[model samples]
Structure formats: C-alpha cells, structure tokens
Target: MTDNSAERRREKQPRTGAEQPWEPEDLVISEGKDPTPERLEEARRRLADEGPSAIERSAP
Candidate 1:
C-alpha cells in the first residue's frame, strides 16, 4: 500500500499566517474612485456622441 502518513501530517500542521484582507481607504465616489455608475454613463454618452475614436467623452 502507498504510504500516506506524511500527507496527513502536513495537513495537520498549523498555518503559519492568515492572509490580511485588502482595505482601500478611498472605496467611495467622493474620494475619486473609478468604476462608478457616473463613470459608466459618461462612457456610453461618449461612445454615442463621439462615435468611436478609440477614446471617450468622459472617463474616471
């Protein structure tokens, strides 16, 4: 039979550390974060108005 004790031991070992969660301070619109609804609307408006110039009328 194949030996499996090492694998079990490895699984039993305690974790060296836990990963810290990312927490950006500016997770709001007032702080000038990107990807807001305002940014999307502006992009659509630009596409309709400008008609595809590889650029847009507005972006965040």
Candidate 2:
C-alpha cells in the first residue's frame, strides 16, 4: 500500500446497505388506522418536533 491517507479514506468508505433492515415489529400500528403517507408525514412531524414518546402518544 502507498503511504497516502486519501487512498486509505476511499477504501474505508461504507458499502451499500451496511446498516440493519427494520423488522415487522419496527412498524408501530395504531387501531383503525392504515399506514398511509399522511400518517407517515404526521409521525415524522411529531418525531421531529417532540421525539419518539410524543409520536407514540399522538399516533393513536
């Protein structure tokens, strides 16, 4: 190997799909609700503003 830091940096770059995929349980289901785009937006908004606990509270 050459004594070049730039070449080492390029070699250590992440591959595709290096992270774990979510399971079915990763999806939070609410009663009488479908997993639609609107719901997804709302969840995202809640999560962004107030985080996971607020999302759980506001979801159902």
What are the lDDT figures for the candidates, one per model?
0.44, 0.49
Candidate 1 total steric clashes:
0
Predicted structure with the largest lDDT when compared to the true one: 2
List model 2 lDDT by residue over 1-60, tens digit each: 568898889779764321333222222343245667776666566555655455345333
How well is each residue in 8-55 modelled by candidate 1, as lDDT tens digits?
Answer: 998997643212221222222323557567665654564455543313
TM-score of 1: 0.33
Q: Judge candidate 1 against the unseen true structure and give its global Cα lDDT, from 0 to 1.
A: 0.44
* True-structure lDDT of candidate 2: 0.49
Error of 1 at 48 (Å): 0.6
Which regions of candidate 1 deviate over 4 angstroms? Answer: 1-33, 54-60
Say what the RMSD of model 1 is. 14.4
